[model samples]
Target: MGKNTWIALFAVVSTLGACAQNDIRPTVRISPPIAPESTAMAEATVTMPPSGYLDYCMRNPAECPSSARDATHPEPMTPLRWAELDRVNTMVNASVRYVTDASLYSRQEYWTYPNGRGDCEDYVLAKRKMLLDRGWRAETLLIGVALDLEGLRHAVLIAATDKGDFVLDNQLEQVVAWQETGYTWEKRQTAANPNIWVALTGDAAAPEPFEAPATQPILVANAHGAESKPEVGTAAPAHTIRQDAEHAESTPALFASTTDAILTIPTPKPRPLLTARPVSADTFSLSYTTETPVIDTAERGGAINGAS
Candidate 1:
């Protein structure tokens, strides 16, 4: 081969070798995706109160009670005197008339001491005010929301006493323990800081059992092919059916035989051939005939052949 030809062949081979090396290079790999950690732990650590109450607090900053703001001051955790608690609860409940914020202030939500009439939250605020006036620490008294027996949202004043947490409700005449109200505890203001609130854990009380709905009993056919009417009101127990069966056994044998005869009578078999045949395009006739017997006036008292 000529010198230029050999040089051209060598360059082509070098290019091919370089291309092969590039094609044989190792590929870059990517790691598989990983699932994110759960947020339940975060939710457990940080909690908040109801959105409605928080929004009200933010909008009516001026209406925030002075006691709530000064809740941070150290106070003795002394057991609340029962007589004092009862007095304060009853006095505040009677002093305020129940009215809604919309009806009283022409606003959606407002928290303040009621002059004469106010809503549930208003009653709570008024009770807190009275208790504070009576030298009770602000932290001991809190405003909370709970689901009433009807599952409706309700607000009440919770007084933290050494005996237990007692609720002062405007709907009730007297104070009651928090657990006895059958209310679902949602959230409450912190004892350490009235301005802050925390989520309540654990089930409250189960709702009361409701009476079973009334139902109409289905009509059933007896052995004699007659429908039996059931008595109205609550259903009879299983034992009642046994008693009825026993009572039926004491019935007359003739009636029992009649019932058995009615039940045991086999249904008449269908005719082997149809007795009806078409006679004309517009009408048809039955092959069998039913004859009526003639009666004379003198023989009217005589017995008929098919009479039972």
Candidate 2:
């Protein structure tokens, strides 16, 4: 090692000088994650450290690995950045969280938030949306729908981080191998748009078809919500068509927060008189259903059923 190497070593040591072992606190215990409400299975905890991450600064040297000839010597990654990304992916998905179970609902959009409901596709979609907001590349995140070792349809998020392809899944909180996740490959889709997600079942893996990369400029603003749109109530094309396709493949739980989007939401307005039309497959349905009253409740907390 030369002068530059020595400087990098000193910088790392200086950063770690304040991490005293005695200042660390005992770990807090946490039980294994369960459905919305159920018995806990395991427990673990994290404690506070005096300097928090100061120890890592020393543990991971600031300098590039000695084998590198220059700053960008590594083709895909440097040792340090790869490890950092892995650490993040592992922690973020450490506890597979879901609003409910995966079998009661048929498709990703079927059920509302309830205790232990929704399918596997529902789980993958939710985590991908969260990670996107954290600044992952939209093009790089792929949702892989497949079958797990248990031979059930499953969906998982494939994140191309500095540490290679890291997976964020709903089966376990810890981000693990795409192979270890036990999802036999079925289909891959672009995370941002579902319309263009599906390909011809088992074709070759090209980002696009047997075509060249387009030359169109991708504006980051319109592409990634750089500027907010101000109008609504008539944005999404009002078409009347729908699809009844339900294949046995995995997908994440898909829901988008539309408060900020241009898509209109229900407003307290009278329905405009017009001929009724069914929505098409290209469009989405905001369908709802209500049943006849089974019991009557007066203002007081008393229930009355016809027979009981």
Candidate 3:
């Protein structure tokens, strides 16, 4: 049996200078869940980093170009250079495939045990480092993200580019055009010092089990052999899109069922399923249709909790 390693830490490290004073640390649970992760795209010359990307300013202050006055260094050397980065992205994707098990860290801090690679956040770290070395802006690009009404800890790259804001996610490889990632997002900064993302939502979660595609009744033959419409409620495939330059948050429902014994098909009333697109090395996205008609609820309430 796998040993359960747990730490109940009751200390929060959020206080910047406060860490110096009232050192009341938050009691944090050590066994964290699988983190939601992302990636970036072909756009380049990250010089002048996109707006609000400064939080990840520089891995090492000395190595980064001091001051934007000589800002042009961050710009992509050429349009073709983006292509070169694409080729280099193979490592990030390979790293994702290397480690299939969930690890207990985010971005660069996550563990890649026994010389293997994986864990959602780790994918983001590898991609970011590659982009930076390729001359992408240090301050202009950061792992940016926001949670929804449901408190799942989803992460995305906030690329401050001359073109505009873009999101990079591990769910797909195509760079998203920011506005197109679909989720209602709020601006956020990455916690890279020790390598973590600070929660934008204090303690609220989006909702349980991210939304699944709407179900159209499935038709099955009843035991009696007569053709009957058994109210077989089945969901459609979650959609995907490579549009834009952002990494999209992906839920399990987004992918088609992998079961080998079953043959699943869509309903006659088909809704559009966006094509899956790739970005950087560790991200992907596909747009899915929710129950278009809003769902009604009972008077009694439902339970909610944080996803991280």
Candidate 4:
């Protein structure tokens, strides 16, 4: 072969060998981009169970219902299921009488499904058990804590249905929509995982610290119906107003200013007039005159003669 031809053949062989080495190297795989809608759906679906419920489950694992650990998500609720939910809620509410945990269990807080008489948590657990037995998915039946209409801490069973979330409260016999319950939801069991819980967003966030509402200044009235103003330098006495039972038990007394604390100052009576002076003669003066008329006898005699 010619020298140029040999050189060209050697260069071709080297290029082919380099290409084979490159082909033998490991290949890298790239993941597909996640869709925004899916990401949002995932975020929206994520939830957390109540802390009390979790603690109860941990302490009494055997007592914990199977629904708590069930990973299967519930199907959308149908009309039949909705009717069943109402019936079950009403049945449980009517059957169980309201009683405090402290009175029954000798503890301040206990979560259990009571047999005859029980408190709020008991009512929630009983309803959950009945629904779960009726084939409702555990994920759909969530136990949550919220402030009731009276701003009291209460436990309720939240049924996540296709229609919307509905609340079963012991205080109310009707199974009302969750939004209509007037509750400030705090935390609830995750729909995906019952063992885990997430803090609820928006209204579910830890409630703002309870602020005793501003009290209007009360006006103190006297026997004469005259309102008296408080003295400038006097400090108003502090009045303690007991808040709702939940707050009253957990928090300190809320201090407020009341009219009862206002000091009453008696009005000074006017002094009677003591000095009396005599009236002067010039102050009361009067003028008077008397006169008499004489009779005309001569004229009378002339009238008598003319008549005769």
Candidate 5:
């Protein structure tokens, strides 16, 4: 071959090598993901804990175990875990009676697990304790406070899971996603530390403490001229009992309080478990009913349940 022809061929080979290294294909940028990168709620500035929380912590030290660091991550959701959540939520809701602190303890706010009769705060306390006892992580099971649809302050147990945050509420029987609860979430205990809470709202200040409505002593009416006394273990009248979706008359037994002398008490009946049909080992349909009440009471304040 001619020398000039050989030089031209070498130049062509050099150009091909440069083109290969440059990767002349058109640059295509992938569109950013539309779905959120994380389902976990966005936490805001750290704020003061709710009223009566400190006192309650004083009474029960085990619940507020860590204040310094993040102890555990959000729980990974599973069919068995979902069933446990539903069981505890439904059980506590049905087993506890809603009464104001003034009516029961004669105080504005009191936080304790409901035994037979108590108010909203008591109900929440019961659910949290039960879940913790079931070996659930303390950091994942957070106490959330929000303004209800009625602008009443309400409390719900927020279970932070890999899927999302779920609310275990006393007012509603179904376990629902936090965003669907119709509550303006104000604050919740931080996942890093159980004792330290962070505001969901942008502000860092703590919300105003809740004050219970003043309740008058309930008096019983009698048709006859003779005084009437309630039997030791009888249920309240049908009219006063709140009917369920089935319109069935199911309520707790009414009992007279020695201090307040209130005779018209409606006790809670044990509610049935949510239908837990497993879709797979890791996933499950937690939806129980379509007729579930959507409104969660924001009454009183944090630590208070939906009923009172």
Candidate 6:
């Protein structure tokens, strides 16, 4: 109501406004969510199928047809289908006793359905057969070859589903995703034709180009057969080592004095240990006279009689 009161109220409003304007809060930066792990493997160049698979196909014509299927694609995986896969994988793994082809049939390699005992290939065939009997498509079930953790050849049944590719292995009881198997995939049956195989490109990358060392190290060997690298100059300019006698003789002489000094030089080896020279008869007589006392035979006899 009074002038001073009104002035005080205006001052309070201005102070509040300035405080609100000056207020600063820390800014938070949120990063985008991390993407899910990739679960699929890509097919590379087509290649030859395994020899054992061909033999098995020859025996069973109905299973391996030469013609390609039109509706070849990944099957949509459901809970029931997943359960069925697990059941087949576990049952076959338990029932079959692992026996090598050499021990079982006196052959190096063979692929066939297992009765009670069989090899890895046989176990794969038996699982595929059981899955086929349970109304699964042939295209969905693919036979795969891979190198195990120990880098040994192995066989497994691959189930191609919408979610991801899963492996049904004779060595494992649980149906596992192919990516988590830790095996280097080599080849697998193509979806178009069960008999034809294609190479798998799983996380394969082109090798990095080789780079020359920035500074060449000099390796110095010790008396105890151990070697050490000493700090040395940078690598020489790109020049080929002259193998010819004329160039080899000329290049080394120039290398030491050149502005761009070569990192390495051939160390001059010391002459071999001084060996005793084979002496002639004259030299031998001279050497003996100089070093040893010479006495006449009569004098020597006289000295011997005196001693006696």
lDDT of each: 0.40, 0.29, 0.31, 0.42, 0.47, 0.49
lDDT at residue 173 of model 1 (Cα atoms): 56
lDDT of 4 at 251: 12
RMSD versus native structure for model 3: 23.6
Q: Per-residue lDDT tens digits of candidate 4, residues 125-241? A: 778877877898776787666666656667778776544566777776556666666666655555544444445542322212112113211211122212122233333343222
Q: Write the per-residue lDDT of candidate 3 for residues 77-168, one digit (tens) a residue.
A: 24444453444344454444533322323222221111234433345545665676667756545554444223333445555444344545
Q: CA RMSD for every model?
A: 40.6, 24.2, 23.6, 43.8, 29.7, 37.6
TM-score computed on alpha carbons, candidate 2: 0.36
Q: Write the per-residue lDDT of candidate 1 for residues 272-292, one digit (tens) a residue.
A: 110112222222222211111
lDDT of model 1 at position 79: 36
**Model 2, 201: alpha-carbon shift in Å?**
8.6
What TM-score goes with each of the models? 0.44, 0.36, 0.34, 0.47, 0.52, 0.53
Worst ten-residue run, lDDT, model 4?
A: 11-20
Model 6, 3-39: lDDT tens digits are: 1111111000000000001111232322113211225
Better of 2 and 3 by TM-score: 2
By lDDT, the better pick of 1 and 3 is 1
**What's the candidate order when arranged by decreasing TM-score?**
6, 5, 4, 1, 2, 3
Return the clash pairs for model 5, or none: 70-192, 120-305, 121-303, 121-305, 152-298, 152-299, 153-298, 252-267
lDDT of 2 by residue, 53-116 (tens): 1111111111101111121111133344334334444443343334323234321233121123
Clashing pairs in 6: none
Superposition-based RMSD of candidate 4 using all C-alpha atoms, in angstroms: 43.8
Q: For candidate 6, what's the RMSD?
A: 37.6
List clashing residue pairs in candidate 1.
99-118, 99-119
* Candidate 2 or 1, higher TM-score: 1
Highest lDDT scorer: 6
Task: Please list all clashing residue pairs in model 4, or write none if there are none.
Answer: 47-198, 48-188, 48-197, 48-198, 49-188, 49-189, 49-197
